[model samples]
Target: MGPRPEYPRPALRRAEWQSLNGEWEFGAGDEPVFDRRIVVPFCPESELSGIGRRAGDVVWYRRWFDAPEAERLHLHFGAVDYRATVWVNDVEVARHEGGHSPFTADVTAAARTAENVLVVRAEDPLSDKTIPRGKQHWTETPEGIFYTATTGVWQSVWLEPLPALHVTRLSLVPDLRAGAVDFEVDPGTDFVVTLDGEVVGRSSGQPRGRLRLERVEPWHPDSPRLYGLEARLGQDRVETYFGLRTVEARDGRFWLNGEPFIQRLVL
Candidate 1:
């Protein structure tokens, strides 16, 4: 009902992720007041955050959650505008600069077993030309081409538990012409690739492998079919999915699935 409640990281996923979306204490100063309740992952400019007003240059947010039992705990933020400084249980954990990319911090040392306090300080000065503002506006009122600024966290924030030596990343490249998909995993461990509960391929203690599909069901706008993918390395496991599709341009024309493509507006 609320944005599907799914793990935001689709490419690399783990089952031990907890969503930090919902209510959080919000304030507009160097020190948090804890008087306002704003929804996480929604900027104050939006109505969903319960504070549908323009945000200050320096804003603060606070959240308290029960720490999950794990050997390692990682706090992930999909995105935060401009610059953000985070603290876990009064210990400075991370400071990230950039508004468009995701960042994570290992909070295993700062978090307590029962409960943990997370604080975020977001600073987005519109006058800072060096920082990328995207479509956010600078003037007091919104105008042409410039939209309302998204100052604070505009994406998902969550915590994930991980083992000591886990599969950190995966790169999947689909080859429609060859009817196979090449993959590479971090840590260079032997991994198995499964599609829709069936084993498609396996790696031999190497970081690379290929999965050959028996039938190629190309993904398109009409039929957005996808295959469930699972990869396991030792005791670490992750689930992801992939869709095979191709697009190219030739002779000053567009092509999809090796055929001529045309755009049709629904409106």
Candidate 2:
């Protein structure tokens, strides 16, 4: 089995997808002449990679897979430390920065039917403090609060097929006081909002609207009630969930679900 062989995105999920986590050709250079194998989703500095050594500033990863049948295909990376440049079938598809955020590239134009080569080049400077390093130590060894630095692709890589006019983005903003959630669908398409498998609201030729719940269930630490949210736009559908709660700090104590609660914060 491959490492971390699970759906990378849990908040928003689709039924059909493919996991790209497994062994891949790994090397350090500008070219794609890989010299070693590494377990992906795991950084080179970790033991799981089989190459428990620093990956310097630049590293390369190469792999191949058959393209799935769909109108459009998207290549998703949960994250790649620092900067990442992707090439599909030797055609540059995406270039992204920021080590902690996820990115995707539309590979429909560059992908082939039978098989395609995917190459990724990650550039993470070991000593660049200007970039967000978080808890990673800049030195070769760990010291004090700092720990071993992680470089290159350290999260799941996957692919999913979509229609040409599929839903691109969905934003949900929970309003605890109003007992509603304001939603906005990209491209301003007709949509239906469902809560816990029940249709709660519908938008006719409108994209932004509010979905009010008949019964307000304020999420608390003890109860922790969450409402399953499903938004459908034509043939595209996405499944997600949201909790309704509120927090305030004006009372000199923590407030959760409109009640005063003591807070213990740990880092």
Best by TM-score: 2
Superposing every Cα of model 1 onto the true structure, what RMSD results? Answer: 2.2
- For residue 243, model 2's alpha carbon misses the true position, in angstroms, by 1.1
* Candidate 2 clash pair list: none
Summarize candidate 2's per-residue lDDT along 131-181 as a digit string, tens digits.
898888888898999999889999999999987777787788989999888
- What C-alpha lDDT do the candidate models reach, one value each? 0.83, 0.86
Cα shift from native, residue 265, model 2 (Å)? 4.6
Lowest-sum lDDT 10-residue window in model 1: 191-200
RMSD of each: 2.2, 1.8
Question: Which whole-number lDDT from 0 to 100 does residue 9 have in model 2?
Answer: 90
Count the clashes in each prediction.
0, 0
TM-score for all predictions?
Answer: 0.91, 0.93
1-267 per-residue lDDT for model 1 (tens digits): 344287799888887888889888998876676678888788998998889987788889998999888888899999998799999989999999988899999999999987688999999887888877677788647899888888888899998988888888888898878777888888777655555567666566668777687667778888886766666777788877778888999999889989898987693
Error of 1 at 150 (Å): 0.5
Candidate 2: misplaced stretches above 4 Å? 190-196
lDDT of 2 at 124: 89
Best by lDDT: 2
